[model samples]
Target: HSSMGEVWDEEMSSSMLGSRLRKVVQNYQAMNKYNVENTGPGGVASRPKLSGSELLCRLKSQVQVLTLTPDLQPFASLSWSSQLPVKSVTSELGPYKSCAVVSSAGSLRNSGLGKEIDSHDAVLRFNTAPTSGYEKDVGSKTTIRLINSQVMASDEHRFLSSSLYSNGVLVGWDPAPFSANLSQASWYNRTDYPIFTQYQRYRRLHPLQPFYILHPRFEWQLWQQIQDNMVEPIQKNPPSSGMLGTVVMMSLCEVVHVYEFLPSRRKTELCHYYQRFYDAACTLGAYHPLLYEKNLVKRMNQGTDQEIFTHGRVTLPGFSALNC
Candidate 1:
């Protein structure tokens, strides 16, 4: 069985991350803030290694892309019953032939991929990554925008009034306690942010827009799949918005092209193309299990590494494309 250090070494081989970033990863692993417990031998060590195709099948069978249905709790018992959309996200906006998941990575700043990104049948972008000035690189189309609860709750983001959010089908997600039951009470009591209140307010303001909260169980289930596939435990925190957005697109589109989620040769210290913030953690991961998430996506990539290096792109077949 591979040790945690050994697995990190493997990542370092390709990432060429500096010692400081390496230390940050080790710190998060040691913290395991959410208290994930994986006491058995690692899944990869316990079973024969599965081919990428088998891994894709496993993901198709195991991970479910679910959104808050009106019938589910909290929202069901509350006034949200009438506000929530009757159709699932997939049913409402899906079955596209091709889609793009554009990460906010700084590497995209001058890649000149805007035209290509906009060509997809649909485009999925994360949080407040604007497509205004950067349309030369990041494209100007947004069919879906998957946001973290923090974004919905923050006054700084102008979640209720920002034109940035007014476009696209908005989906919100929050990290609940790792062990909490998927009940109305449990979820309301322990969400990482006060997203419920903001969500309700937004619904009242934009009664016509299609906005849905992602089922909390979806995040943890995807986290479990990530942990199960690896040789060592990742951070107990939830997957990044980028990873969750990728899976959501996978469920809705026939083929998903993810951009900059995997760093290209143009990788830089800038956290996002839109902001002046600079943090390697945004790419390598400090809070979210971003490194493991990237590795997992790389494993499932049907595209060539040259694409990853050149376009910062990774192509993944959507769940519907998988026979399993």
Candidate 2:
């Protein structure tokens, strides 16, 4: 098993990325798409670093896994307010003894982790990743599916007609401005993706499905924790859905075992297990601070390096399990 630094740095280094991907990471860094303004003390190098346990405690105390509610604006006055799930995500689908967070990484292709993933009381899958054919590799059970706004807003995904999304509880999120102020008019006016219309449309069709939109603050707060723990500035974009979903599970479950969110020895350039596409950016960071996010997860891992190598798994105690 490789050290965390060896695996992450080797894959994330400029020398490892092809020229095209190198340029893409640089371009996103320059874009600062979310208008992120770093107000924290310099970086990890500038301060005494917190141990993994301390970091975990801080996260348990500070990060709030919140979803949009009737109290929030736009939703408050809009027709969709009543449609929003009345229960918190934790109260609605949580407090599980064991939960699994399944990543779409290509490294999962031949790992044959399906049964183990399904063993969890609840399983969370991201975006449009499927399990029909690859059930041996990825579990067939999906208790919750977390989607980005792009999946809902883009017709290319066939969001309205797809059966993949219909089986599980659905949670959607969009990258809001860095301020993360839901009360501001600017936030609703300029979301990264115009998903509100599509979200409402889906609600009308499946009135009984438990669908929820994550509050924008959840992403920015999680992003700040990632930034605060790093030595260098990460990409200005919000954390990826993998990172967001991991935290969401952390909040709801007693234990979270995240599979392949960090690459295993089986790591490959193939983006998703079900897709033939290849891109290092999908594993590392291009638009999202994936590398940094992975590093933070590594720090908080309760599992051993051998587990990471063999199973591509990192086990974490949920907030309820933490003493803090």
Candidate 3:
């Protein structure tokens, strides 16, 4: 078995809830471990890869905005509808020579990648990872902000009132129970949180800002694709917002320059660069299917291991220009 598999084996043995379940999961992983070679293409589109047009269609179709319910219920005090953004986001900021995806990982702490990262045509950051004081490391440019519903529903002071989220194109997603019934009514009834209500309120506060909630189907489709490609069956969770954001940028740019998604030799236990908390799970992942996701990313990356280890940067051809 490979080092990552070995590590996962050890981790799961101790952390998994029950013995029978752990054995079943491990057995499934072992079956797929050598089903395909590590050097082959990541499970993205099979060996030959999708043509640019097909790939474009697939990605574009998946990127959609969830329709919000007309009536504000439960959280009736907030003016949700009027506060929403002017319209759904319809950006085509792509076909560029290069772009950057700056992860919030603590591995980025002293990379001095600000100038290189800022030089890209566009940059994407996640959640509430700030660039104000950490500009020397993470850069100050913000072309996009991809957040989860937790970021939207929980922190009104930071997400709603702060000027930090005011500048960039905002995309948020809340998990839904079923992919088939992701309508406004379904979303109203089954959302993990009342993010739609909060979204409306935030929109009322900043109508001019471009804000869009991701279609629940798009998230599930992405998760499904990731699972189909993985050697091991992944946890039944959606891909992390970071992975989704990377795909979004790929569709919009010519070349996606990803930083710290694969971590570096300077990899630390810290969860995010802006915070001081520590956990190896932040890099290897516990809640997310992150280990499998990283495996796919490392396989698809056009850059070398030296670059990833030293600079924490990985280069990938954008989906807009991809032939496979």
The most accurate candidate by TM-score is 2
lDDT, model 3: 0.67
Which pairs in model 2 have colliding backbones?
A: none
- What TM-score do all the candidates reach, one by one? 0.91, 0.94, 0.76
| lDDT scores of the candidates, listed in order | 0.83, 0.85, 0.67
* lDDT top scorer: 2
The alpha-carbon deviation from the true structure for residue 236 of candidate 1, after best TM-score superposition, in angstroms, is 0.4
- 1-324: candidate 1 lDDT, tens digit per residue: 522121111242213558888777767767855556652344346765567778889888888888777786666787757777776777778799999999999999999999999999999999989999999999999999999989999999999999999987899999886663667556676677888788889999988888987876778888887777777667778899999999999999999999988888778889999999998888888788888888788888898777887889899999999997
The segments of candidate 1 whose C-alpha lies over 4 angstroms from its true place after superposition are 1-17, 32-44
- Candidate 3 lDDT over 76-131, as tens digits, reads 34455445443334343445678899989998998899999999998999988899
Ranking of all predicted structures according to lDDT, beginning with the best and ending with the worst:
2, 1, 3
Spell out the clash pairs found in candidate 3: 49-324, 50-324, 83-203, 83-204, 84-203, 84-204, 94-252
In candidate 1, where is summed lDDT lowest over 10 consecutive residues? 2-11
Worst 10-residue lDDT window for candidate 3 reads 5-14
User: Which TM-score value belongs to model 1?
Assistant: 0.91
Residue-by-residue lDDT tens digits, candidate 2, 4-96: 532333123333567887778767767876778863752447687777789889998888999888767777887668888886687777678
Q: Report the candidate with higher lDDT, 2 versus 3.
A: 2
The alpha-carbon lDDT assigned to residue 267 of candidate 1 equals: 87
